[model samples]
Target: MPGARRLLWLIPLALVVTGGLAAGATFLGADRIESDLTARTRDALVAAELPSATVAFDGRDASIGNVPADQRGRARSVVLGVAGVRTAEVTGQPAEQAPEAGGHVKRDLQVRLDQLLAAEPITFQPDTAELTVQGTRSVSRVADMLTAAPANVTFEVGGHVARVPGGDPEGARTLSEERARVVANKLVEAGIAEDRVRAVGYGDTRPRSESGTTDLDRRVEITVR
Candidate 1:
């Protein structure tokens, strides 16, 4: 009878372990789904010229913010179009007023910039500020975009570097600054007004990824102002 009792107890224990594993897998799967959905939705928003909008997800449902009142419909439409997005809730300023020209132009420029960087991010050689061939091309494209932008529109060229173990922080800062200056100089050579561009360096301070230094960490970002 004792053996039978122990067998019955072991069966429940096995069932409990199996159930716990299944729950863990389900949680992980949901997390992955949410992450994928967020990426796709952001890309879609950028493609639709709504890059300023921010997206957050609860399961498959998305909550998008920062969209202008006039653009909520379009933002929601694009978010819904992304596969696996079950629903989208868009919130922003009420659509009672028309969007101003400056606001519209800024958003347009940001969207184009996001699209360009997404396809070909500007990268530099390891431990140096030298631009790779592809990086030069990417900078050229950005310069072209800036030249076409409104004269009042200005941009900031922000430089960043990946953190290295036992590396000199001051050296990292200097390298990032040089990289920013290089990109800013190229933009000027491409006919963009010198005064319209500003350069700043963030040395291993703002990492895009926590999984150590990546190529993405050693890169430049352009922000419309």
Candidate 2:
């Protein structure tokens, strides 16, 4: 009779052990899977020069942010390639509009222009905000481009900087602000009203490079809103 009583006690003890193990397994498995998913995302984005992004999973639905329309297709493609990623909720991609859509002509141009600006940042003297000879030439061309743009459109200058080697923590902000200001001033010289052009510096607060490389992360984007 004592042996049977002991057996009953063992049954509940066994259940408790099994339950604890199942919970631990679940926690570890989820952590491992998400870590792998994030690494894969970083690799693909860095390779493509797309902005850095993050993922959050609640069950099989993964939320992804910081992608542009030009790169959203790629994001979806790569995420779907990962095992167990059921649905990817992607946000922050620029809204794509066709020129033939009429009212969207300005927005369409903005997307293309932002892409161009990201590819090339206006040149400056080493460690200084002063524009180089080449930079002046670039801005001159930009003036003409802005002059030709729809008069009703408002142009915004966006400046981005990275946490760089040999650069002060506040330096990133100062440099970015100056860069944006210089461009905005040039636009005003090109005949655009000061109010029509908004100059805003994002500093190192909004980094775009997944690889953390300063060169690509330091950029200025011109957008129409």
* TM-scores of all predicted structures: 0.54, 0.47
For model 1, how does the per-residue alpha-carbon lDDT over 47-152 read when each residue is reduced to its tens digit?
Answer: 6756457999999999999877777888889999999989999865643332333978899889989999979988888888989788899998888788777667
TM match of model 2 to true structure = 0.47
In candidate 1, position 170 carries an lDDT of 94
Clashing residue pairs for model 2? none
Model 1 worst lDDT run, 10 consecutive residues: 92-101
lDDT of 1 at 15: 96
Cα lDDT listed for each candidate? 0.85, 0.69
CA RMSD per model (angstroms):
14.9, 15.1
- Model 2, stretches more than 4 Å misplaced? 1-103, 165-168, 211-213
TM-score of 1: 0.54
